[model samples]
Target chain A: MNPADRALEDLFQEVGPERAPSHLHARILAQLADKAEIRTVPAPLLARWQWILIGLAAMGSILLAVMLPGNGSSTGWIALLMDHLPDMTSISSTLRTTLIGGAVISGILYVLDAQLNTRVRPTHG
Target chain B: MVYTVTHRILRNDMDAEEATQDTFLKAIRGLHTFQGGSRFSTWLYSVAYRTAISRSRLRRTEDRSLDEVEGRPGEPGSEAQGTTSDRRRALEHALSRLTPEDAAVVTFHYLHEMSVDEIVTATGLSASNVKVKLHRSRKKMLEILQEHLKEEVWTLRTE
Candidate 1:
């Protein structure tokens, strides 16, 4: 190296980088602490297996309802659903309206709850 | 190591400290992604270098000019005259005048004792690019040193 480069190497060794401020260490540790706390709080059960379990239960219910021997017909699942379609319309108007309204409100609330939970959750990188 | 890389780029103690903190946080969060293909220190240096660059860019956008945001070099300490500390302060002042990338390249080459290949890994530059930048940075630092410490350079050259 030339004289100037040698001098700079020496100077840099002497001075080095400044030590980080004490408070910055504290701030980083605090963030890590918050991250650890967030990790420790187990994810909600609904967030983990609720959807899968719901799908499985629905599938099981449909299989049982369609395969029951009392149907007295070798019809496919779609045909069975079509056969029950009239029974669904036979329900009273007030009961049907109330059920449909309740289902819509429940779906909306579930979606909103999921969105709020995601928004509040702490993100890493 | 993080502080050294960040300080070279940011040229401000407070900003360097903030960048260092950010680097650590990012490294921790991204730890699972680390493939262990490089040395841990090299990977950490990469994080610090990128964080410092990002912080510099953010500051530039907010302040409208880098020169306005960089900290003014401190006056040489009187009691430390003619000592190693004096020479260090003079060198630091010169470094402060360099662009952040130039200063970072110089620091990584000299102070960190990083090979050009290692620097290429840290900075994500090609091998030839890293070599070219290192050469340019060295020339710039030499110019700065000669400008700021003419007598000292003369003395060192003679010795």
Candidate 2:
């Protein structure tokens, strides 16, 4: 071997990582579990509080749908039906009541989702 | 196996056990994004390195001095190499003086037996940089050990 290579070999023998204490691996693994790729959400996603926001949005939509005159049975998309159906006075009262009930159920779903999320979150940032 | 990543981070056998658990927890969660390009161990090492560095930083800040200084075997000047333990200690002492980054490169190469290319992937350093660092770091370590050995010989002759 060249002098440089030989020197390197000798040096490696002196200050190599193998001499490091063994517990370092375990410490690293523990830290990783809490913070990195293994977690349910990425750090950025958790930071944004996206799950909470999504839950809130779902609840709001359900509320609007339930309180509307049509019983959420409108032919168009639920949001659009809720918006335009108010103009249709000819709709039956029974249909409107059913739609209102459905909206209430949706709102309940959102609340449940929010509660689940709150349970799963880390306590101390 | 004796020189594995796990042992390096936490010296206490118990502490090492806990750290290994933590490392796997972190690795499993991040497994999906791990491209198949690198060895699992290499990727794992990066995670381990980050974890170790963060802990070291925290410990330093809290204690106002590094606490992991006890395991070093002996000063490089000690030429007591008749025993395996002596040589090992000499190596550890010589390594302790290196900057953490240089120490890391040396470890990856020697302890893990990683190639320059593997180290490049693991450390995210350019291949040329790895070569340069490895070269310089090795040279410095050898010089330190040799100087110690020479001093020891001189002392023996004088005595």
Candidate 3:
């Protein structure tokens, strides 16, 4: 090491370790007490499981909708609407297309918003 | 250690105290991940270093130049006696002129007695980068001492 470096090392050693203010220990203990209180409340497992199940069900519904065979004949609500409202069938096709597109776009936006707002909760190992 | 590291970076007593508190709180919260692969002090210092850096970034306060530091030595001869307190003041003034990162590097390298590898872990810098920064910081500190305590520094160097 150079003389300058040696001089600095000597200076730092002469200074020694600094002592923190006396109250800092007390302050840290107080904060730890407060944190301990907050941590005691266990996370709600049921609510988390419910959200997981809801997500899985939603995903399954989407997959089923995509995988199921598409018959030429209208089924369920569409068949009922077509049977009772034959005069409105032309506009119904355009409206149905618009609603599906809107729903898909809304789902995408919702997922993105959720992702952006999600906070990483600290986990204890 | 936390207080000193934070003070070196923040350059404000109150801010350093607050950052020291935050550092311990973070360490407590993240204790489970410590894994004990290195010395505990090294891990703790790493936490303190990061907290101080983040606090410094958030505040973005302007660092005072060497000339701007209050009670700086007016003449080189004035510091020749260089009592312990005088040496302390000189070091503090010199550290004040350095950037927070450079000060941190010096504090860890010299005061904390951390090895380059330990500093690499603490600061998240590569070995070569830490070496480069350490060299630059040492050079800057030497320059500051030469400017402020020319005779005393030379005497210490020759001793």
- Top of the candidates by lDDT: 3
Instruction: Report, for every candidate in turn, its global Cα lDDT versus the true structure.
Output: 0.69, 0.57, 0.72
Model 2 misses residue B140 by how many Å? 1.2
Number of clashing residue pairs in every model? Answer: 0, 25, 0
lDDT of 1 by residue, B88-113 (tens): 77677767767777788778888887
- B16-113: candidate 2 lDDT, tens digit per residue: 45555555666666667689788888888777666554554455443333345443434544446535455555566666666555666777887677
Q: Which residue runs of candidate 2 sit more than 4 Å off their true CA positions?
A: A1-125, B1-3, B6-20, B60-79, B149-159
Worst 10 residues of 1 chain A by lDDT: A36-45
Candidate 1: list runs displaced more than 4 Å. A1-4, A36-125, B61-71, B75-80, B150-159
Candidate 3: where are CA atoms >4 Å away? Answer: A36-125, B61-80, B150-159
> What shift in Å separates residue B29 of candidate 1 from its native position after superposition?
0.9
Error of 3 at A121 (Å): 18
Tell me how far the alpha carbon of residue B94 in candidate 1 is from the true structure, in angstroms, after superposition.
1.2
**Candidate 2 CA-lDDT value:** 0.57
DockQ of 3: 0.26
lDDT of 3: 0.72
Better model by lDDT: candidate 1 vs candidate 2? 1
Winning model by DockQ:
1
